[model samples]
Target: MHTSPLITIQAITKSFKGVKAVDNLTLSVGYNEYVALLGPNGAGKTTLVEMIEGLQKPDSGSITIQGKTWQKDAAFLRTIMGISLQETKFTDKMTVSEVLDLFGSFYKLGKKVTRQILQTIRLEEKAKAYVVTLSGGQRQKLALGVAMLNNPQLLLLDEPTTGLDPNARREIWDILMQLKKERGTSMILTTHYMEEAAYLCDRIVIIDKGKILADDTLATLLTSYDPGEVIAFQVSSPLATNSLYEIRGVKDVHWIEEGVKGMLTVESITHTLPVLLNLVESSGNTITSFESRKKTLDDLFRTMTGRSLHE
Candidate 1:
């Protein structure tokens, strides 16, 4: 038997002031799949999300959720979709429970559902706390709780943990992971944090200038687009950058500090490292610092786009 994807976007294009924000993009999300939409600022990630969320209409092509178009099935679609934007504001005077209760009422949900959502978001203790008194992370959890009230099958989170500290961010991740494990929720997350996307999403789609540059599992993207171990080292003295490329398995060399500090993308560190060290020693340049690690999504993004995710 064959099953359709949870959401389908077909060659959708959107423009603003004669500038295309999303240029003939096509994408899909499967049932229970968690996808991360990663790109730099003005990359049209938000624009694409807005169209999916029914907040914007594309100039051309179509978007369908569970094979239903937003133009015709919006009423039914709204019931199955949950959205947590980059920032959600609550009345400062409203308690956490009250906030959830208010949103839940829109769906005609009962107190029982509110209790469960509070527990699911790990904010039961803060149920009585006012929104103004809650921490930034707690507020985000509340926003997530509100989004989850409908028991939505699809979740859309836009930079949900952008400003939180590491500990706070992990808390959000834990809650999201729980949702995926327990309820099999499909999700589309837009974020600037490579680690967050790497940790949470099963598939990553990197978009730039309203176009998808790379889309695949993290490991596959690394291996297919730019495969190699990264060797970053600092030397005691300058050396010819071109000479490093002569080593076997060395694919690319980037000089962070001209000839003194450099990084190498090599097919095999075992083959390249020894030769690199010998060359440096023979050239009378002592190694000051060295690190070798597997190439990461951040490295892949830089290779494809020539810019960092945050940039």
Candidate 2:
């Protein structure tokens, strides 16, 4: 509900040689908002983040963090912002405490990263352990702790939970939620995990091929762009595709054949299930199994981008 913009990208365009990487991209993150930058590989997400981080300059446009542009306030911005990249490689010889101390020293007015920060990241017990001895999840938590050592107002997290096990990922999510609640820290997250974005983000900005595909809250996006449910069923015999198309209120019907059995996807489950079942029964076909689910981020992504997230 905070209306003040904490981060803004205005008319941003970045190119490599002759090809555009980010085309006229305009995005903003409000104070205390959690926004996700979602896209597939080669979708200009990295390029856009790099521009915001000031690691790469855009071909044309402007980026401001907390009403200050990088060119005019690079040093001051570093104090107010924290960035955690996808992969952080720390010295194997350093203990967790040593790593935190090292990062904390870089800021002029950085908060003293104490045992509480370690406990917050759930790494207090591992404080004395060497960096190389930590598991992937622990290392990631430590990296997050380092990013937050300065007690930044804006946190930029890039794929924070990628490559983590479910339990480990959930731990990170809990920590993030705790931070959001306790500190009201604004965050801009870049991730491919749809469920993570849905659960953690207030708004999702979907980018593809250097363009913004959709920018809105998940509920709004799903309800407006993708409505209804998908009912799937397995049959003992191949379903008559022609008869499926005749079901009243059915938006679309698709099926897959596996030897003598088949699976179908019907868009209108509530309106078509009863009629479709009767029609299949009358046609001498038996349904072996059935399931139905509301349309999710996967379906919406495929609908917009013409491919799955992995592709």
Candidate 3:
């Protein structure tokens, strides 16, 4: 059995000043799926998102939201979609509640959802604080509250926690996770942080130069693009680099320093870890620290695009 996607983008193309921001890109989001859209600065992430949001028109292509076209059903589109951009500036004097009320007024729905949204975003305590007085994370939370005023089915978030501190970012992530769990909102998040994508999204869509480079679940992407585990360790004494390579299941070894620490990409940790430990111990060297993890989306992006996601 197959079901139609909740949102579909077909061969969308957009350009600015002879530069193709989005070059015949197409994608789809399933119902209640959290997808992360990732790309470098010039990769057209913002352009593509705007086109889907109906803020920018594509030169050529079709965007359908729940089988509704923006051209024919713009009002309906507004009612069902919530967008939180990287930065949203409100009147400095307006309080959090005031800002949410102003955005809520745009829709026919009244103040019923405001309290719920405030509670969801954990801004109930600071509801009376002016927008200018709120911390960066709180302001971001208010922005999310405003976006959710219509109780949208589709949520488009653009770098929702770009500059926030670790604690604030975690707070935002927690709020978003709770919302997804409770409302099942289909969300498309655009972020440079690979950890954010891995933590929140069911699938990852990597784009480069206006085209999708890869799209798959985080596990699938890791397995398909970077199928291996990296074991990194620091030793009290140096072991010969060639000796490390001779360990079972070690496909490759990269020394961070000739005599201090190094990393190994292995085919099977079960086969390699014990052998590695034994080798280090037998060679009169003690491992000061050891850790291992499979390759991540960050590695996949670098492999495919030869550039950092933040570039």
Candidate 4:
């Protein structure tokens, strides 16, 4: 039997001041799926997400969650999803437990569920700690805990770890992975971090100029679009870009800092690296630093859009 998708969007469009923020876009999310929406700022990721969340209405087309439209099923739709925005603020006087209990109360949940939520977010030790005293990461966990109070089936997270440090970001990732593993929660996460999207999402959708440029699994995106390995290095002296391209297996060369620092996309490192080194050495251009790795989503995005995710 074929089951319907958990969320369905068809040709939805939204505009502001005669400018289309989300141009005729269609997308779907499957049950128990984790999807990441990656795009540069002003790419309409947030606009699309807002429409899906029923926080905003599209100018045209339709959005349905579990086959229910927001116009008619707004109440029921609210019950099944949890949202964690880029930033969440809580009263400074409220303790961690108190904050959870307060949000839980909105869903008519009690102390037992609140206790479980604290444990799930690993904030049991900070139950008595005031919200103001919590670190940035702990505050994010609390925001996540509040979102999960309803035991929502679908989670909408908008850059939940945006300002967090690496260690703090990993902690947020761990909690989200746990939720997906134990509860089978479906999620739509919007993030600026390629590493976060690659690690946490099963499917990645890259949007630009209010349109999806690439949508697929990480491997497919990497392979289908200019499949290759990446070599990034700096040299003691400037090197001609055309010279690097002459190496066998070299597909493309991108200079990060004119000729002194650059990255190359090659069909095989084994074939390209030795030749590249010999050429550099013969030309009297010593390598300052060198590294090689598999092509990543970051590379794919740059290839397609000619811009970095942060740019």
7: Cα error in model 4, Å: 0.6
Residue-level lDDT of model 4, residues 18-123, one tens digit each, is: 8899999999999889999999999999999989999989999999899899989999999999998766889999999999988999999989999999998888
Task: Quote the positional error of residue 176 for candidate 1 in Å.
Answer: 1.9
Q: Enumerate residue pairs that collide in model 4.
A: none
- lDDT on C-alpha atoms for all candidate structures: 0.91, 0.82, 0.86, 0.91
Worst 10 residues of 3 by lDDT: 302-311
TM-score of each: 0.95, 0.89, 0.83, 0.94
Better model by lDDT: candidate 1 vs candidate 3: 1
Candidate 4 overall Cα lDDT vs. reference?
0.91
Candidate 4: worst 10 consecutive residues by lDDT? 1-10
lDDT per residue (tens digit) for residues 1-311 in model 2? 54559998999999998878999999998887899989999888888987888888988989988789989999898888888887789999999988887787776433344566787898878989999999988988888887788888988888888889999899888988888898999898889999999999999999998899999999998888867677767778776566667777665554445423333344567777888689878978888888888877776787787676778
Show pairs that collide, candidate 3: none
Residue 288, candidate 3: C-alpha displacement in angstroms: 11
Estimate the lDDT of model 3: 0.86
Summarize candidate 3's per-residue lDDT along 1-311 as a digit string, tens digits. 12789899999999999999999998999888899998777788888999999999999999999999989999899888999876688999998888887887778556777877888888999889888999887888888888878878889999998888988899888877877888888999998889999899999999988999999998889897778888889999878988887887787677767866987889888889999889888988899998898876765676676565766
Candidate order by lDDT, decreasing, is 4, 1, 3, 2
